[model samples]
Target chain A: MDVLKFITCGSVDDGKSTLIGRLLWDSEAVSLDIREAIERQRKHNGQETVELALLTDGLRAEREQGITIDVAYKYFTTKKRKFIIADAPGHIQYTRNMITAASNADVAIVLIDARFGVVEQTVRHTLLASLLNLTQIVVAVNKMDLVGYEEAIFEQIKTKYLVLTNRLKLPKVTFIPMSAKNGDNVVTSSENIIWYKGETLLNYLETIPIIPPQTAESRFQVQYVIRPQGSDYRGYAGRIQSGVYRKGDKILVLPSDLPSEIVKIEENLQEVETAIAGQSVVLHLKDNIDISRGDSIVVQGATVEVGSQLQAYLCWFDEKQALTNGARLLLQNGSNTVKVIVQSIDYQLDISTLEKIEVEKATLNAIVKVRLRTAQPIVFDTYNTNRQTGSFVLVHPNNHHTVAAGMIVLNENE
Target chain B: MKINNKSFDYLDALEAEAIYILREVAGQFERPALLFSGGKDSILLVHLALKAFRPGKFPFPLVHIDTGHNFEEVLAFRDYLANTIGEKLIVRKVEDSIQKHRLQDPKGRFPSRNALQTYTLLDTIEEFEFDACIGGARRDEEKARAKERIFSVRDAFGQWNPKAQRPELWHILNGRLDKGENMRVFPISNWTELDVWNYIRRENIMIPSIYRAHLRECVRLESGQLLAVTPHIRLEPTDEIVQLPVRFRTVGDATCTAAVESSATTLEAIIEEVIQARVSERGMTRLDDKLSETAMEDRKKNGYF
Candidate 1:
């Protein structure tokens, strides 16, 4: 079965944990012993209802505080597909954890309370997901039973969300109305909303196609070299990330555009005829080239020029330090790491309003645009073209801490 | 097209990635080793490494940290696998660390050498100058492990910092380290228990018979744990000894390892039984984690791999 990875985001009281609990409980993912533990805890706490959120929140501190403190992964599967859910925290203090979880997700499930439609937290999550290049957004308006399952409220909330998501430039957006507490329109169709005509949230998740970024005619980023002992053949090792390559395809090594050929593709002893995106393998060439780590090996049809200047959308994750101009960092892309300096701050973005504010500086949990200069030239396409090669993280050299998360943008337009 | 006559999917992709990582360590790192303990997880790691570099001798040796108090069957199985594979095997005893005064014995009724394995492991690493030590640790096994990266960096003193870690992105893994520092690569970090069983079944790998049920003499301890009646175990008259049909769920130091009563004697039956088990693997097997809330975290910070 294919894998489907998605992230869950919302406010502290938005029932993100409860929604996950409902999904697991209704889908028969929880074992009987786990259920017994939940029951035992419920009795000890003097609560009448069995807390489903207890299933994912593993830490004792989280159980005592009654909130998610970190990104806890929950795995389950349907008949058609398998899933890995990254459940991120909703509190403002834990925004860094949310960013780390959403960075790897193929889809973002942005939950919103039906009673409070399009709140600041809701828009912030959507904006964060969009800024991270997660295009598939599923807006789940939870707590419909509290509002009497009113159709008018659902429609109003969906309309407001569509406008907000459109301004964020998300490629795909789907809206669903559900009550996680009562299990309405989550796993099964609810009889309350007769006017609603769409698949349940579970149905949509299983059917969504995980189409990897098309790297069909683009570039290849060489991560390392694979040399099997007692063999004269050597191959460039890395995943294709975007496009396809054949046995005799002519490729270019970036920063010099030196040409090479695909001699062979070997995993172990068996040789493969062709390789596509998402398959990690080694590529051998007829010539012994001066290829090393951090070098981009690209095909001829689609080539990207080397550049030292980059304009990117960055999410500041560090609360202890503020990002400003002339700040030095270790900019990492693929396997390459080089010193970088922040040249200028373009504009700080308002995630809720989608407005650009001209500011000299901003503190933690702020999203903004900036220009950077790297010590070494890096090659890539825009974030829209390839998600793997177009993203990077800025690490602090002194301690090797990941201070900021960045997404590649069009330098000309910005 | 099928790569190895198996259709390409996410799990298969993950398996290929893990194999690629194993091969990379063999090619790049100068001195490397595999840590084996005759456990199911570590057994699975050895199987993967064998497939990773086939038709040639294993590039690295295998090291086992002997606590001097383990089941005779498990220790025999450990030696059996190494000799059958025709690989060099090394054993570093905790008793040696005690004799050298590197570790002090905890004088108590329930004395365990589990935590002292760190000293023996580090000493062996220094003695052999091994740069990378591959382990079979899954993130879902424990909460602290979930925060671990694929290529986890350890300080010169072998300490792990939860707050300070190199950012890992895409399929790019940076295995570079300065002098005195080393990397602990976990190829099965993304796998779950169910996934491991599925793979084991699919590969038809041979494992120790202790994983299956058998009749054994055992005694019940104070913590409500059943300890096998081995010569290494100290028995008292107060301890109730009984004969039960039981098998080990996890193989570790014989003192801390517990056996669950069962009659599962076949692989297919064991797989079906695991599917219906309510308690997690670690919840019933591991006694070290029950000491505190952040026990694993504290151990990891102090250079316990």
Candidate 2:
């Protein structure tokens, strides 16, 4: 089955946990014993009905305080697809945890309480998802039942969210009126709302195309060099982030561009005739050309120049330190780590507004565009085209802390 | 050969990714060993290694930290698997540690040697000078495991500091470690329980028969778990003998392992049973996990694989 990884982001009491619990409960993905445990906990808490949020809240403090504290993963599979849900706490303080969870997610389900409409927290989450380049956003207007299932109320919230989406320029946005508490338009379609003509949330998720990092035109990076012992069988080891290579196919080794033929393909010890994008394999060449880690193997016409300077968007994750010009750190991209110095701080984008805010200091939760100078030539593509080869993380040399995550930008003028 | 078919593509992709990691470990680390137990996860690891070095022998040997209280079926199956696969098997016993006065023996009949397996493991790593030990720990298995990276770094003392892990970026796994330090690589870190079962069914892998349910002599514990009646676990005066249909989802030392009463005799039935199970397998069966909130993390710090 095709795998779909998604993350749920919202503040506490927005029914983020309840929506996830409802999806799991209605889909019959949760086991019988877990359901019983949640039921029992609900009765012990003296609730008239079982609280779905009790299923994902595993910690004692979380259960007692009724708030999510950390990122928890929940798994469930439907007949058509498999889903891994990264449930992150909605508080502002847990932004780091949310980023960690959403870093790998293909879609971001940003839940909003229908009564609250487009609040600041909603904007914060939407901004983060946009900043991370999460293409799909599901603005689940939950708590519709509390609004008496009124279509006008839903429309008002939807319109407000559309205004926010316009500002963020999200690639894909879907608004669904849902009552996560009562299970409306979540897993099961609500009969009360016949005016709405859209697939149920689960149906949409099943059909949504998960955009895996597919870039056919960008340069390919070779991560490691694998040599089978006692044999002349040597190969370039890495996953093909983009493009395709076949046996007897002619290619060029970058930084050198020494042309060679794809003699053999070794995925582990098993040999294949060809490899495509997303297949992590080792490619043996016809010649004994010097191809090492930090070198790129490219089809002759598909090579990009190794650039020493670049502009990129960065997210400052360090709370204790401020990122400014000339901040020295190790910038790692594909198996190559180079000493990078921040050359200039262009501008910082406000988390909620997405507006360029002129600031001398880019503090925590600030997203900024910066120019960087590396000690060595590095090969990369623009993050807009290829996320895998285009992104880099800055690690503090002294403490090995990941201070910032950078997205490579191709257009310097824009 | 046909790009038209995406059938088995995900598995093929995941398998290739895992093999690439295994070969990377072989090339990067000076001394590395594949940590093998009789468990299905580790067996999958062995299979991956075999595929990783086809036409040649595995680059490293297999190490099993024996608690000396393991189920005979598992031990026999372990040896059977090793011989059939043609790999070197190294067994380091906790009993030897006890004999050398390196470990204190618990004086009770139902003593747990689960936590003490760490010393034996750490000593074996030192003895073999294995700088990297590839384990079969899935992040979906437990909460502490959820925080683990694919390439988990361990300190010189075999301590795991979750807060001090290296930032792993897109496919750039850093295996660089200081002297006396080691790494624990989990290839199937993203795989869940259901995924493992599905893969086993798909691959038609061979597993010990104990995984399937059968009649077993057992005693009920305070946690509502059924413990298989064994020689090491002496029956108390009040404890009564009961024969129940049971099987183990996980295999560990018999002293600490618990069984669930089931009638699942096939992988299909087992998968259905797993789908229906309300409590997690680890949360239900493992007594050591229920010991404390940070039990798994604490054990990992003390070098328990």
In the range A127-224, model 2's lDDT, one tens digit per residue, is 87876678798888888888878889889988888888787777658989888888889998998778788988999889998664433563456655
How do the predictions measure up, each by TM-score? 0.89, 0.89
lDDT of 1: 0.78
lDDT of 1 by residue, A181-245 (tens): 78888899988878889889999899988865443455566655655579765667666666776
Separately for all candidates shown, the number of backbone clashes (residues 3 or more apart, or on different chains) is 4, 2
lDDT of 2 at A261: 78
Clashing pairs in 1: A215-A242, A215-A243, A216-A243, A235-A283
Off by over 4 Å in 1: A191-197, A213-219, A228-233, B1-5, B20-34, B50-63, B80-90, B99-111, B119-133, B152-184, B220-226, B236-246, B261-266, B290-303
